[model samples]
Target: MEETISLQDLFKTLKKRLALILTCMILGVTIAGVVSYLLMTPTYQSSTQILVNQTQQEQDQFTSQEIQTNLQLINTYNVIIKSPAILDLVIERLTLDMTPGQLTQHITVASEQDSQVVNVTVKDPDPHRAADIANTTAEVFEEEIPKLMNVDNVNILSPAIVGDNPQPVDPNPPLNMAIGAVIGLMIGVGIAFLLEYLDTSIKGERDVEEILDLPILGLISPIPESDVNLDNVVRTRRKRR
Candidate 1:
C-alpha cells in the first residue's frame, strides 16, 4: 500500500517545525546580508562611446547601402577594440600593471545591432580608474584602428567621466538575501519531512491500528495510584491542603 498525506498534514508539519524553519531563514538572510554588504568588493563601471563612419563625409546624403556598410564594419571594429593591438597601447598609456588578457577581462565592448555606435565599458574597484581605462581604451583604439585597418572611420563620440557618487554595478544585497532565504526555507522543509518520515514509533490508537493493521477494539485506562492506596491519597490531599 502507498502512503499519502493531505493539506492538513502538510500544514501540521510546518506548524510543528516552525521554529526550525524560522531560525534557518533568519540565519540565511543574516549571512547573505553580511556577505553582500561587507565581505564582497563593490565594482564600479564607466563607459565611453565611439562612432563608426565612412571617411567620405562630404557626401550630403548617405544611401541605405552606405549606412549598412558602416554598421557591418562596426562588428570588425568591436573585435579590434578589445584586441591586443588596442589593449597594449591602453595598458601602456595608463601604466596599468596587467597583461592585455587581464585588461580585457575588465573591459566590455558593445554596440547595438545595425548601429554605427560602439560603447566601451570598464569595471574596476576605483571609479576613476574605471573611467580612465574606458577613456584611454577608446583613445588608443581610435588612433590604432586607422593604422591597422588602413581606414579613418572611428571617431570618439563621448569620453567617460567620474561622477561625485558612482554606484557599484554588482553585489545586490536584497536580491542575494532573498535567494538565500528561499534556499534556507527549502532546506528547512526538507529536513522537517525527513524527520517526520523517520519517526515510526506508535504515538496513539490510530498509529497502533496503522502499525498492527488491525481494528482497535477499545482503549485500556490506567487505575490511579490514589485509588489503590487510600491512606497515601489521604496524606497527599492533606499535604496539598
Candidate 2:
C-alpha cells in the first residue's frame, strides 16, 4: 500500500524531532567556528599592479592599435607572471623556502577587461612574506620582460606594502559558521524525516484503525482500584445487614 503524509504529519514529525534538529544546528555552528578560528591556518593577501605600455622611444603617441595590442598582451602576461621563469627569480630574491611550483600556486595574476594594468596577488601565512612576494614578482617580471619579449613595455604601477596592522583574509569564522549551519539544517531535516518513516509502532486509536482497516465496535473502560474497593465495601455492608 502507498502511504501519503499530509502537512499535519510533517508538522508532527518536526515537532517530535525539534530537539534533535536544534542540537545538530548547534553542533554544526560550533564545529565550524572552532575550525575557522583555531584549527585552520589564516592566510594573508598582498597584491601589486604593473602597467603594460609602449615606452616613449618606441612610440611618441598612443594609437588605438597600440592600445588594443597591449590589452591583448595582458592575457599572455598573466601566464608568464606565474611561470617558473618569473617565480624562480622571485623565490631567490625573497628567500622563500618553496619550489617554483609551490610558489606558483600562491600567486594569482589578473587584469580588468580592456585594461593595460595587471594585478599580481599573493597569499601566505605571513603578511610580510606575502607583500614581499607580490612586490618581488612584479619587479622580476618588469626587469625580465625586456629580455624575454624584446620589449620594455612592462612598468611597475604600484608596489605592495605591509600596513601598520595587516589582516588575514582566509578562515572567515562567520561565513564558515553560516555555511555549516545551512548544511546542518539540511542533514537534520533529512534525519528527522528518516526517523519518522522508520517509526511504525501504533500509539493511538487512529493508528489501530489504520493498521487493521476496521471500525472500533465497542469500548471497555478499566475500573479504577478506588472505585472497585468502594463497591466491595458496599457489598459487605449489604451482606452484614
Candidate 3:
C-alpha cells in the first residue's frame, strides 16, 4: 500500500527543520551579496547613435521606396560596424591593446525596426574607455562606409559621453541575492523532505501503530523513580502492620 502525507505532516516537518532552512537562506544571501559586491568585476556600458539617410539631388521629399531602402541598408551597416574593417581602425585610432576579435566582443549593433537610426553600444571595465570605444567605432564606421559602399549616407547622430559618476551596468547585488534566496529555499525544502523520508525510527503511539500494523489494547505509562520508591515504602509499612 502507498502511504500519503497530509498538510499536518508537512507543517510538522517544516517546523522541525525550520532552523536549517533559515540558516541555508541566510548563507545563500550572504554568499551572493559578497560575490556581487567584492569578487565579480563590474562592467560599464556606453552607446552612440548613427543615422542612415540618402542624400537628395533636387531637394525633393524622400519617396517611400527610398526610405525603405535606407532602412534595409541599416542591417548591412550593423554588420560592418562590428567587422574588422571598422574595428581595426577603431582600435588603431584609440590605441587599444586588444585585437579585432576581442574588440568585436565588446561591441553591440542594433537598430529599431523600420527606423533609420543605429545604436552602437560598447561595454568595458572603464566607463570612459567604453565611451571612447563607442564614439570611435561610430566615427570609423562613418569614415569607412562611403568608401566601402560608394555612398555617403551614414551620419553620426549622437556621440557617447561619460558623466562625472557613471554607474556599472553589471553585478546587481540585490537581484543576485534574491535569486540566491529562492534557490536556497528550494534546496532547504528538498533536504527537509529527504530527511523525513529517510527517517524510520518510531517516536510516538501513532508511529508504533504505523510500524507494527496493530491497534494498541492499552497504554502503560512508566512510573518515575520517586513514585516507585514511595510505593515500595508504603508496601513495607503495610507488611510491618
Number of the top-ranking candidate, with lDDT as the measure: 3
lDDT of 2 by residue, 1-241 (tens): 3467899989999999999998888889999999999999999999999988755457667799877777677888899999999999988887878999999889889996767789999999999999999999999998999899888888999999999988999989999999999888888989999998888999777777778988888767889999999999999999999
Superposition error at 88 for model 3 (Å):
0.7
> How many clashing residue pairs, candidate 3?
0
By TM-score, rank the candidates, best first: 3, 2, 1
Worst 10 residues of 1 by lDDT: 53-62
Per-residue lDDT tens digits for candidate 1, residues 1-241, read 3467889989998999999988888888999999999999999999999988766755888789977777668878889989999899888888999999999999999996767789999999899999999999999888888689899878899999999889998888999999989988988888888998998887788777767778999998877887879978788999999
Off by over 4 Å in 1: 55-68, 220-241
Considering TM-score, which of the candidate structures 2 and 3 is the better prediction for this target? Answer: 3
TM-score for candidate 1, please give it.
0.85
What is the Cα-based lDDT of residue 97 in candidate 1? 97
Give the candidate number with the greatest TM-score: 3
Q: What clash pairs does model 1 have? A: none
